[model samples]
Target: MDKNTIIGILLIGAVIIGFSIYNQPSEEQIKAQQELLAKQEADKKKAVEQQKAAQKKQEEIKKQTLEDTTALFHQALTGSAENIVLKNDKLELTINSKGGTVTKAVIKDYKSLDGAKDVTLFDEKDQSLSFKIDGKEQNINTEELFFSASEKTDSTVTLTATAGAGKTLTMRYLLGKDYMLHFSLQAQGMEGVFSSKTNAVNVEWNERCRQQEKGFTFENRYATLTYKEKDGGTDYLSETSEKIDERISETLDWIAFKNQFFSAMMIAKNDFAPNASLTSIPQQKESGYLKEYKARVETFFDPTGKTPTELEFFFGPNDFRLLQAMEKESKFGKDLKMERLVYLGWPLFRIINRWFTLYVFDWLTNLGLNMGIVLILITLLLKAITYPLVKKSYMSSAKMRVLKPKLDEATKQYDKPEDQMQKQQAMMQMYAQYGVSPLSGCLPMVIQMPIWIAMFNFVPNAIQLRGESFLWIEDLSTYDPIAEWGTNIWMIGDHLSLTCILFCGANLLYSWMTMRQQRDQMVGAQAQQMKMMQWMMFLMPLMFFFIFNDYSAGLNFYYFVSLFFSAAIMWALRKTTNDEKLLKALEARYQENKNNPKKVGGLAARLEAMQKQQQEMQRKREELERKRKGV
Candidate 1:
């Protein structure tokens, strides 16, 4: 029985085994599946190999491009550099073959700051002018390459260079009798050498301005980078900031490196490219360098290399007259307006200096008078011009002096804060009745301040007075040091200037005279305040002595003469004016004002309105206070 059961179970198990085996995949199908998997693996391997081949080809192209660029750069830099010199009546320039740029510029008529030798604005190591050309196959900098010089002359020179692949660049320079040097840059036969899409060439100009003045701090204060936009006005970087980095998106007309009394300018006859940049970094205090200036500009360039650009270089003193004449005589049909480099205050003060002070100074110098004498005469002339204003101011002060007793009586009624508004109204009424304006004296003084400030700016920057000598002073443009301690102090330098001391003395005397007159006119608290301010005025001269000790001797001398003239004129005014007559006139005017009861206008009307507003506010404040106190 066990055999029969086992056989049946075995038969069922065999049938199940056979069915499972039949349902499984055949060998041909398995082989086909395996072949498909293998084909996919082969396709992925082929794709990876193709990708690697593409990357290798790209790397080879990059390497070839780098080698081509290096070869081109080497070709451009193969020649030896040479230098050519050109001289004119005012300037001497050395042109370098490397970049066909000015390597050195010397002023023939000027001496160094120490009076040891001729002044050199820049040297080979301190300046560079370079061009960057972006071509289809190569990019190169001209500054690192060399050029061949040809057609050399005493006042002109031409340089030619190759940019590989039938491209040529030429730079020509011509020096005139004046401070101007004409420069031209031309590109020839560069059809496929540069990128045809862009129409601009990049230029870089850098200069380290050496100190050529007696005062480095003063010179550095004036050292700045100035630029004029094409069809726009002139602008400048901040001179007082530590570093300046500016970008101009508009076209530029010119760029300049302006020192205190001199400048080096580059003028573009056409216009620069639409984008440019300028940077400046001040050197160390004792580095003998005023500033480091850099300009990155773009100029119009044709890929066809047909047209050329004309430019100009001006290396000279910052003489206002010369610059003005140059502006008038410009051949580019644009006013360069280089005279703006002169630091003679803003427009109003500059107009005064240009129209009055400089003309007078020139006239006086033409008379063969020494600069000191010219300064004195100019001071006297200016005093005469302002004598009317001074007299009016003094007369106003005297009239107020005559009315002081009445003003004091009025002020006594304003002893408490509650009476402040009423007291102010009463004082204003009295002033209106007497026709005495408290600001009249100050107004006249304010009108004369611009002239004084203009002169102060003009004298220090006047190149005409640079080497002019006067009594006890060898150079008027620098401090006349009577003694030098060889140590720097706060505000005061190591040297003591005689002209500065004299200026301080004159200022002190003028201050004393003015203070005495003002003090005699005031009483009580005002007199006390005047006395304190008189001491402060005396201290002002001492403070100025320290400040001016290192300043220009011509400026100090001019100030001294101006102060002396002011004191003398004031003394004469006091002697000629009769106080009793002034008092009587003031009383008569007051009586007439009371009788006529004239309608107030101008400042009096404004003051009355303000007083009314203030009195109303005070009344409201008192009413509120009473309500709060329930009184």
Candidate 2:
């Protein structure tokens, strides 16, 4: 072997020896590894045994739980349910033995939207209510259990659920002569049957509200789930396809499933717990229902049966004046604010109706005139009160109309775009000379807008107009179908309304007259803008015909009558106005303005400042152009 090969072999052997020494395990490490493997095997076996034992324990617990729940309430769980009737002057209630629930409610001597049948506010298929008892052995579900009912009186009943060892839960109901039903629940010989940790019981209320009116769209828009929180303002679920409210962090005094014209309200004297949930789900139009409303709430419970939970159920029409009188006469309803269920509108319009229109309407109704005549009188009264403002607005427009010749001559003088600033300046000067304020015409109309919108909210919600008919109208609260095809169509609905057509016709005539008066005043770009506005205004009445076809006859009648009165007033003012005399007065005022320039003030002053600024800017632009061209 060569010398280099021999050295390389020795080096390789030494490196292998060093690596073996570095990685070699000690006796202590080998012992520890074996112990670890043994411990792992032992742990695996212990886990398998524990899992099997836990499963067996769970099975035993479930069997015991079943026995605890079902053994005592055997009779209560197996029987068929029976129903009993409770009648009064204003309401009839059907009580079921199964859940101790009010299965149905009918309003006495009242007709629903159909105008033919007595109003059935709710039936067994539409609503159900139940209580879940929190007990010691098990959380008892009372909904599926039966109770033995006893007749206490003509308007009162007692339903009792008895278990083994003579323990019992009893529910009692008393129907008042009015629309309210008093309810209470108590326990007897059930000392150890309730859990100590739970202080309240759960209440389940589910309602698929039935359609109460022919106009589903109108009825659904006004219906919602309304509630009043203790020491807080009244609130409600949003009117939409689906909504849920689970954030009620305060005790509540009452909750209501409010329909458009009626409601089924539950008022708790002791108040409900802070934890509650409310849900709203809309139903299909073909289902003959408005929406589905559900509420899961909690109420205070007494384990010892010392005091019973007390509540009152109100079933009646949403009459504003009646509810107001009831509130004044109630012991617990002082703070209830139940009349809010009859919505007026948002704050501004509501104020108008609440403070003015309601009082006038009630007075007119008390006068014993026909409803149609009452509406006409109200329209005439409103027109008379607002005559001064209307006269001033028309006179302003007429002043501009009389100056058309002077305006046309100025238009010819400043026809080019470059003279636009001069034209505006000249127009402002002419308006000042004629002593006219353009916005004077609009401010008065603006002041009258709240009244118009307030009436729109008032007419539909007026319960007094429900069945009152006049002049071939069967019901004023719903649409009067002068022409109905018995088929649903987009935008036009299933009917053509007579009042709606009349209102649109009056509106079109008014629009044409107003446009003719204003068109002569506009020139240049403003004239083009006026033409576009004219088209929009003319189209509005046509669109309103389609939109308002399904609206209540009362609302359409109000609009039609109001428009007819307005057009007549305008014609009267125009006939009384003398254009020649008005023009001579304006000429004299112009000569006076020429002599006394000190009359420049108010909006005219502002316009003068703006006109000067425009002229200065135009002069500077011209000078700049000249400089750029080296002029």
Candidate 3:
């Protein structure tokens, strides 16, 4: 071997030795690494232990919950419920031992649309009442528990639910001789059982309003939840809205689940607490249900089982007189005003029906008149009451018709667009001089509109005509379907109503005749406008046919007969009266009152003032334009 190669090998060995010494870990570093490895192993072991402990704790909690739930409510968890019935002259109630509530309500005096069966207000599945008992272990509802029913008395029954060790909840029902069902609840030895701080129980009533009438669309429009606040006016949730949730922030006295002609109402003997929630959810029309109504109210109970929370139920036909005679049966000791459920109309129309139409119809019916004859008599009575105004209206229109030649001559004098206000003013002046107000014809009709609308409202809700048949009509209180199909149609239902068609025809004929009387009296743009209105008026009846196709047969019949007779009367007057005599009388009166200031003091004066103001402004604008043009 060469000496250089040997030296290179020694140097390489030395370099390797030095690098090993420089990169080697110290004793402290090795000790730290050992400690870190031991810590990681300990942490892994701790995590495993914690996971096992948490799982065991969760299992213990679940087991405790199950045991607690089984302790107080074990016997009530499963059982067959008993039904006890209480009947009266007007109502029949079935109370179930499951929830100790009325499971079924039947109005005994009314029949269903099927005609043979009685009207069942609600069945077991349609309605359920539950009482809530908050437990320290588990929240509980009494609707799931089985109750022990006591033997029935003449008018009362008591249902009791025993929790254990003498803890009991009792519900008692006393049937009134009429449509009211009295209910009360009391608790015994439930100090530690009920976790309620206020010692009040929640009373939840859920009800699905089923179709009661033959016309589901029409009847469903009237089915809703109506309530009255304590010391306040009556109110209702939207009948048309699909879903509505309302928390009555104030206390309530009564809540009514009102169908078209029937109602199931609950009245609080004291007052239901604030925050009572009223919910309305619309069900499918084909489901044979109209709406699902729910009311959640809190009422206090006596923990010692002495004083009971009292409530009353009203289940019957919504007969206005009968309901008006019901007891002042609520919290504020005010009249129940249960008659409001039989909705007549809004304020003015309602007043007319309540005061006049109702009494007259009752009197006529009591006198053994048929319902159709009664409606005819009502129409005749109203016409007779306003005969003088009708005569005056016709005479005013005749006066305008007779003076058409002179008004046309005046129109010829002012034929430009700029002369419109002047022409209108001149026409008004002529009307004043002739003692013929253009509004004279309309004023009487306007005054009589309330009575007309009152009858419109009165006939549909007139329960006296429910089953009364006249000619081809089977039921006056529902649509008289002359033709029916199996499937439903949009905007038009499954059937066509005969009375509704007749009513539309009468309306169209009457409108055409009335327009022909006045159409010739207008000229120029006014004539064009009247011609447009004639078409609109003709279409109004067609639109009404769609809107009122499902209205009560009695209402349509009344309108048809009323409008037909009105047209006949107008035609008779047209034939029997002499236009020459009316013109002569107007001419004589014009001569006598042409200068009388008193004759022009009221509406005519105000109209003249407005026209003059408008004319004066028009003149100013014209003068300004002329100056701007340097003319």
The clash count for each model shown is: 0, 0, 0
Q: lDDT by residue for model 3 over 53-85, one digit each (tens)?
A: 966874565456447654665566557988888
Q: What C-alpha lDDT values do all the predictions have?
A: 0.80, 0.82, 0.81
TM-scores for every candidate against the unseen true structure: 0.82, 0.83, 0.85
Regions more than 4 Å wrong, model 1: 1-76, 163-166, 328-330, 406-430, 532-535, 599-613
- Candidate 3 residue 25 C-alpha distance from true site, Å: 72
Model 1 lowest lDDT segment of ten: 69-78
Q: How large is the C-alpha RMSD of every model relative to the true structure? A: 23.6, 18.6, 21.9
340, model 2: CA deviation in Å?
A: 0.9
Candidate rank order under TM-score: 3, 2, 1
Off by over 4 Å in 2: 1-71, 78-80, 113-117, 164-166, 244-251, 328-334, 610-631
- Model 1, range 1-631, lDDT digits (tens) per residue? 2455569879999999999999999999999999999999999999999999967874564456446763443455656778899997788899888777999999887878868556888999888888777777656567766788888988988887776566678888888778888887777876766776757778899999888887676668778888888877778887777554477888888999888877889988878876588888888768999889999888776667577777888888899888887775556778677887787878888899988888998888789998888888888888888888888888777777777888788778576757767766776677777776656667545856887799988998888888888878888988888888867887787788899999999989988987887776664455765755665688999999877887888989988888888888788887888878887887887788778885444464468668989789978999999999999
Could you tell which candidate, 1 or 3, scores higher by lDDT? 3
Instruction: Give lDDT tens digits, candidate 2, residues 523-585.
Output: 666676687667679999999998888888888898888888888888888899999999999
Clashing residue pairs, candidate 2? Answer: none
Q: How high is the lDDT of residue 16 in model 1?
A: 100
Rank list by lDDT: 2, 3, 1
Best by lDDT: 2
In angstroms, the error of model 1 at 569 is: 1.7
- TM-score, candidate 2, is 0.83
